[model samples]
Target: MFIRNESFYSFRRQYPIITILVAIHLILFVWMNFLPFGNYIRALGIGYNLAVANGEYWRLITPIFMHIGAGHVLFNSFSLVIFGPALERMLGKFKFILVYLITGIIANIATFYLGGLAYPPHLGASGAIFGLLGMYVYLVINRKDLIDRMNSQLVMTIIIIGLVMTFVNPNINILAHLFGLIAGAALAPLFLIGAKPYYAEQRVFVDHGEPVFDPNRWQKKRRNNKRLKQAFWIGLGILVLFGLLSRVL
Candidate 1:
């Protein structure tokens, strides 16, 4: 069955977080290109050396926003436009935003650490987008029954496309993609496991055309509270461990 235009619009409207992220990415893609040393730094992201040595450490994260060309930006922006809204709708705004930013940062960190800090600058949100794809695959596989009757082959096609793009595109950071995928797959279960109550409440609101249950909002708030507590201790432990390692190593 064809998805109606109204339905698509409704999805976009309901998931403003994704819209805002996509918009920001597009703007940065254009703006970064005009900055001094932007092109040079982006090439380093692919595997250049001189570009990295110029104190372009921020290139790691900046590259996520910098696209090589119009074609590159279009491809990524299109994917985000299509997949991001649906994921945001399923995960809720807060959790979806969390997954996007955290996995992106972790992916960049992993790339830097594993690729070696000296191994040229890298760029592109592909790592994070790949993470989103990984999460989508997890959800689809876990909920096979729900998608079985539809065009499930589309998922397989998308995965194959991603694989091919990873190999054919010289600028792509394969290691970052792999690490981000793992991170996303791991985190997806955490958010998806207890989502049924939220989904049920969402259905009630959608069908009734009125604000009824808000289990999703409540669940998100509770989860954030727990995560904040965990983060505080985790941060403290990391600082202490780092200090010890510095002194000993």
Candidate 2:
């Protein structure tokens, strides 16, 4: 279910919310890394605990789009690309964006309130990405009709791995991850009021004489099983890489 087989243009047309969000992440990453006054931009965007305590309320929201290291931004962006499209399709554009921002904000708020006297400055989309997993978790338990058994297990595994790493890795904002997950699960039912499951329709929806429903979807499903395994390993690899890089960079 997490495999993104669609082309860039096709995926963008199908999932504008995900596209726009990842775009903002990439742009902000560039501005905060390569451009002039990069440190100034980082200072403004990172969720510095002292800044938030002093009533710089925007820091909570800005941190969602800000990142300091290559591993940090790329890890989050890879996750969004893999998982964001499904939720965006399920929730529609407006609701998807709302949930994304709300979860991220909650993550930031937790970081601010619980980081002792001053939490080390932190920024990344990890919280929001976990929020997406939290939503999938809700579906796995309550809305079983939306997700199949394999995908359900996959979601659970990812969450377990993530939560374990959140505790084991001191570099990550643990509160942010935990609170973001809580927020997402708390908000899932309301946002999923009219939600629907995502189907790989982009490739099948042709303009010409070809039929919309491919007669050989079973073959595709078998292929996707292999893809699911590959995606799982790739995801775990990225998370491990990010964790290692976080320690180093």
Candidate 3:
């Protein structure tokens, strides 16, 4: 008996987190344009000093959803359309959203701290988009069959175009892009490792005609078997520590 493989529509139905994130980003993009001096607006389209002084510290994360202009929003949103669905399908909605927000915040903190406290206000989801790109690159590097199927040359071409754009666009935050890419690459292994046992167990259950487990089911067996919870907590702790360090020292 042949079992029917689920269609892409089904996969997307299971992963609404990406859709929500993209929607939020588009909303912020429109909101940015409506505010005064909005062209320079970043997080919540507020001034940098006001954002910093008013303790609107959440701006760091919120900024990741904002875009400077139509071109900026289009580029990042397009990249999200390309990568976000696949990642959400692979990692589940919760994990995918966690990775995006964490990487984006880290990238912004790196830019704010290392790039100079007085650096111009910045906005855009490019950092998170770049993180997705980096994660995809890592996955391709590790999976030879996938790399062959997708064509490494195509990946190279995209990277080259991004590099050219980085240099050509003076307004682009190259530092944020670099930091996001590096952080994403580093964290890719954690998600990949966490996913392996789950996939392997799923295959085993399917082969044995056992009841397939619900992917989102929060059971002790799934949680403990894969060490996913442990990895997530550890990763969060590390990120929090890094954020504190960046602010203090």
lDDT preference between candidates 1 and 2, better one: 2
**Candidate number that wins on lDDT, 1 or 3:** 3
For model 1, name the residue pairs that clash. Answer: 45-121, 63-124
Give each model's whole-structure lDDT: 0.61, 0.85, 0.63
The candidate that achieves the highest lDDT relative to the unseen native structure: 2
Which tens-of-lDDT digit does each residue in 1-249 have in candidate 2? 688878889988988888888899889899888999988998888888887778899998988988878888888888898888788888889999999999999988888878854678888898888888888888998988778888887778878988988888768889889888988988999999977667633457677757577898899889988889888888788777777887887
- Total residue pair clashes for candidate 3: 0
Candidate 2, run of 10 with poorest lDDT: 196-205
Ranking by TM-score: 2, 3, 1
Model 3: which residue pairs collide? none
Candidate 1 residue spans exceeding 4 A from truth = 1-12, 34-60, 145-151, 196-249
Off by over 4 Å in 2: 200-214
Candidate 3 residue-wise lDDT, 11-110, digit = tens: 4475577667777877776756685655554435432534555577876777788765665566566567655665665676677888898889888878
Off by over 4 Å in 3: 1-14, 34-55, 145-151, 194-249
